[model samples]
Target chain A: MAVTMHDVAQRAGVSIKTVSNVVNGYPYIRAETRERVEQAIAHLGYRVNVSARNLRTQRTGMFTLAVPELSLPYFAELADSVIQAADENGWTVLIEQTGASREREAEVLSGRRRHLTDGLIFSPLALGPDDLPLFDVDFPLVVLGERVFGAPADHVTMNNVAAARAATAHLVALGRRRIAVVGAHEGEQVGSAALRTAGYRQALEEAGIPFDPALVGEAGLWHRSTGAETMGRLLDSGVEIDAVFALNDAMALGALHALHARRIDVPGEVALIGFDDIDDVRYSVPTLSSVDPGREQIARTAVELLVERITARGEPAPFRRVVPDSRIVGRESTGDVPAGAEGRVVGIQPGGVEPVEVVGR
Target chain B: MAVTMHDVAQRAGVSIKTVSNVVNGYPYIRAETRERVEQAIAHLGYRVNVSARNLRTQRTGMFTLAVPELSLPYFAELADSVIQAADENGWTVLIEQTGASREREAEVLSGRRRHLTDGLIFSPLALGPDDLPLFDVDFPLVVLGERVFGAPADHVTMNNVAAARAATAHLVALGRRRIAVVGAHEGEQVGSAALRTAGYRQALEEAGIPFDPALVGEAGLWHRSTGAETMGRLLDSGVEIDAVFALNDAMALGALHALHARRIDVPGEVALIGFDDIDDVRYSVPTLSSVDPGREQIARTAVELLVERITARGEPAPFRRVVPDSRIVGRESTGDVPAGAEGRVVGIQPGGVEPVEVVGR
Candidate 1:
């Protein structure tokens, strides 16, 4: 009832081996032969069960990178970096957007896409400490970002706590005594928001300044508009602050917008700093000062770790966490820094995770 | 000898059908049965060739959307739109970034990805007329953008030339002459750049203004930095212009940056307009006026056309082109307009492509 490879070979007047090669996507096959085989396959309505074939071959030559959303500047640029790294390793990346839902994040672990790729590179935003067990799945996975901790998989991340502290310290060094923090998640016990907030408080304590809860701005989303909205509230509240530290660059840009609307001068009246040195920061009106978390290095390390896991698939390998070196990329948004600030590593101390030999830029 | 599903079924101590369903990712399987089958699959090291299985089933329930880059807000937003469209139709999108390379675009068509999906939605950048015939392939393809012309496939595009004409004419009607156009390609005879330039010229002819070649700014890449770089050159060249019509939003924002650097009064000294009406334009200082090219409509049409092609895969379907209606969105950057400018449908006339019924928004 069904057409087979033998029928296709007979229809094309080619050998079974040639038909198999054509169906398998062997690039070196002659064009004429390939076309004839393709025609026969089409004529016969022959199908290639890719899943079955991949099971036999034991290699799909494809990997997947799942993130919250590609529209976000950080994630979009990170996806591009991941693609570059995947290309270097002779693999293609299948991207999936999880909308930052815990359920959806869990689905990605056991979803059909899991069976489609050789391995996965994930940056979870919604999954929590309770969902850590989901990381113990059969597939080779390498975690990314600061959302998940103690997962039984290789992790590639940056020093979020240290970086955030150094970012706050930069503002202190710029002679700003009253620094307001934007994008603080209320009651956040984990994730980047919590870690970065803790780091900010640590810097304040070290500088002999008391941490003021009223100065911490709340943002449900780290988007530019949210940043602007939160900053607007802070400004309207009559908060006495000479400087602002946004959790991310998008918010910093948004805060700049709010400041611009209010006729406030940047680095003249109030200085602003952000994390994640996205490309937009470089081109911003008064280029944004940000914590460069070594995104490229993280991308490269994630891909490489996934490759190693895929290679050593059956063996029991120790779970390792990698924290790439990070620094602040000072720009005009922060007043004139002393010369030779370029390539200046910000945080000298390590937080919880031991340094796996920081790959300095 | 190779292990088989029958062997996996025996080892898992389940019915062959249960093992088959588990391996095929049918969701109705019991957890105990699934775990047993997974263990058997792992012990046996089974590989499910995805291509072969997809061929046998004659449907992968997946499609791919290829664009130049996702980091570009236009493409990134466009990708988000396509993903939304695909999701509504019960399909997943595999995004491929070609970096606008002709070679990369070709590779997507003939590469392994072709075998992994049922259809493709392609927005080719670096490809040309010579490569049009390559669209005549075995699979279903719906082309997006105004890059390639006369391709014998379902084409979903916007009225680039007409939209550009209306944008330019809007500036002309505002009593602004010597309007410079940013993001012009040097020798492009096809694609959006050339068509948009032609539209700008038509508007100039109607306005009794001579087209100035010196006012055409050259940009190899339609990026903010490139836009800024080109605008900087134009300013340094001492080209006196009262307004600017950047080809896209990113370039418009870049031009805005360049103007801000020069401390030039926006709208008061020089009005600026752009196309694409991306989200950033709304938040831009002295917000941007842009041609709303119906990106959401374009995305919906492309995905729907792709579905139609994929559904009618065996038969020869007549090539169809869908051009959605577009209009200009006035904002702060273009300064004030006379009364009744808000609802103006910028491009009312149709070009060579017969207007398919516009799916009303």
Candidate 2:
């Protein structure tokens, strides 16, 4: 026989309403009464029917987090952070792997699976600023990444351009001339590739160095293999380079692998830096220099924004555009530093909203 | 006005039954009629109420994938593979990060969230064979990993013992007599730690080498930092070792980092091999040697088993246990190999059901 709230209430010697309140996590109930109700429920093996509660509340207590791919360390870490933040808010996360397909990204925004989730936290890779019309859906949505700027939804991003500039400027301070940049999406006018490349150019201009198109390596995907292939091509092309800046840590790691295979000493022959200070950077041989893009802040802010939109009772607030602060983190990949010593900040960028540091992991 | 099935049917010039057939993906509908119905659905902006449909069908078309953590490269790659496989079966996956907590793992098995998912694919860490009774739940469950063996549920695993022995024997064949094993759990009787340790001892016994307790480094968590700390402790303890066998690649990478910090030349002062041939192994400075544990096969098999259980209508089949084949993959971490040369199989284990190869990435 199935156990019911009535059975629990009878066993606990409480009213059915009291049992309901306890099950719903009402905080005002007496501690002794709540304990008795909880004990009765456990003794009776009473399980809450989440679907029934969701139907009554019109909220599934679940939200979707759509990402490009979890195999990528950056996205995997971002998803992990988002799941942790969402768990604190009493929500389960359903993951959707869009594989960076434009059609699939559009399907996610179309509310095709709206019946299964209260809202969505999307990190798009394929759908760009041109797809702003799709963001006008009747659902709580928080967009991540620089793909769709000025979309009709709350957005959480990082200081991509400034961070990239800091990374490039650091290499310039090291007296690196003929610097090469990996993971350039040819002719891209938006997204991380475009913004980071723009920052690279800005840093070069400030250093009185002319931007050389030959030093830009085109990589379709920001994967380790692509990074390695791009670096290998640049080396094979006989282009004299003193430093390399990979767009992400994965690509930078790949570039390191390529350089090692060619017997090119990192920091001695060609210094290197990567974006996204992922955990992998610390374990890389000559621990990688990278940019801390404030991934945890981005995730927490995105979840908070989506939660506000989902639980709003009256008129919706104006959409917000949030950009978390980012900073450079140097290691042996860029220049030799003492073990366990925090890398000295060679150049600091102003206008950051938060204090940042280059702590050695 | 909200568009309904009637409106879609009217616009498609078809009966409501035919429209429902098209929406439900019934295969018997004519191609032209299905196209017309889909076009009508798109034009009318009609969406399926998955929750109401779930109530009628008693199936949510969703499943839960519970892992210890997604930040770990092994679990992240496994989750990516599982999501791809589940998507092919037309199901969505809700992830539960147990954080290796016994209470949380037990709660998942207790059917607390059963109402939201049709089945579960759980990779438990804390709970073990002693908690076999917990697996006797009224849900379609498929377990992964070596934690809870012989539990009353479908299981998919790898050749832990044989694979570990192969890894250890490979190090021994490299003339490394005093090999130190990392990631050992003190006094563990089950799980990967114990099973892999058993294999290490077996290899030593076969080689007529005595097992020394001093060379075993204990790590509670199979994380990179833990691996590094364990290795640092082992090195600091004045233990003479020529080889290291880390239980996992993350740990092996960490151990490599520790070795580098001390200026120990890989394949010179020490040889190392790790389990789980993760993508990181290839990018590691020395290109770590590792065991390929057939992760993709395990994921596909687990998903297929759970799907079968969920869709079963008649008498249930006996629960099955699956152990995929594993092979050792060598790289520069063990010894120098020509670039792009397939890793030579120094010693081969005969029990692998499937033919395996040593391919260089």
Scored by CA lDDT, what does every candidate get?
Answer: 0.79, 0.84
Say which candidate scores most in TM-score: 2
RMSD of 2: 15.7
Model 1 ranges with Cα > 4 A deviation = A1-50, A53-58, A313-317, A337-361, B1-58, B312-317, B337-361
How would you class the docking of model 1?
incorrect
Cα deviation of B70, candidate 1, in Å: 0.9
TM-score of each: 0.79, 0.81
Model 2 segments more than 4 A misplaced:
A1-58, A339-361, B1-60, B339-361
**In CAPRI terms, where does candidate 2 land?**
acceptable
Reference interface contacts recovered per candidate = 0.34, 0.55
- Ten residues in a row with the worst lDDT in model 1 chain B? B352-361
Cα lDDT tens digits, model 1, A1-361, are: 7676667877997655467668767566888999899888888899865555565356778888888877778898998999889888888787877778787688787534555678899999999877765665556789998877777778888798889999999999988988999999999898889999998999999999999887899998888888889888999999888999999988888888788777787878889999988877666666678998889988998999899988773434677788888878777778644311222344443423442321211
lDDT of 1 by residue, B1-361 (tens): 5676657777998755566578767787789889999999999987664555556366778888888888888898888899889988988787888878777788776534566677889999988777764565556788888877677678888888888999999899889998999999979898889988898999999999999998999898898889888887888899898999999988998888788777787778888999887766665666678988888988998888899877763334567788887778777677753321222344443433453321211
Most accurate candidate by DockQ: 2
Q: For candidate 2, lDDT tens digit of each residue in A1-361? A: 6786767878998765578678877667999999999999999999876655556476778788999988899998898899889889987777777889898799888664565678899999999867765665556888899888777678888888888988998999899988999999988898999999999999999999999999999999999889999999999999999999999999999999999988899989999999888888888888998988888988989899899998986555777777776768888888847543345444444323322121211
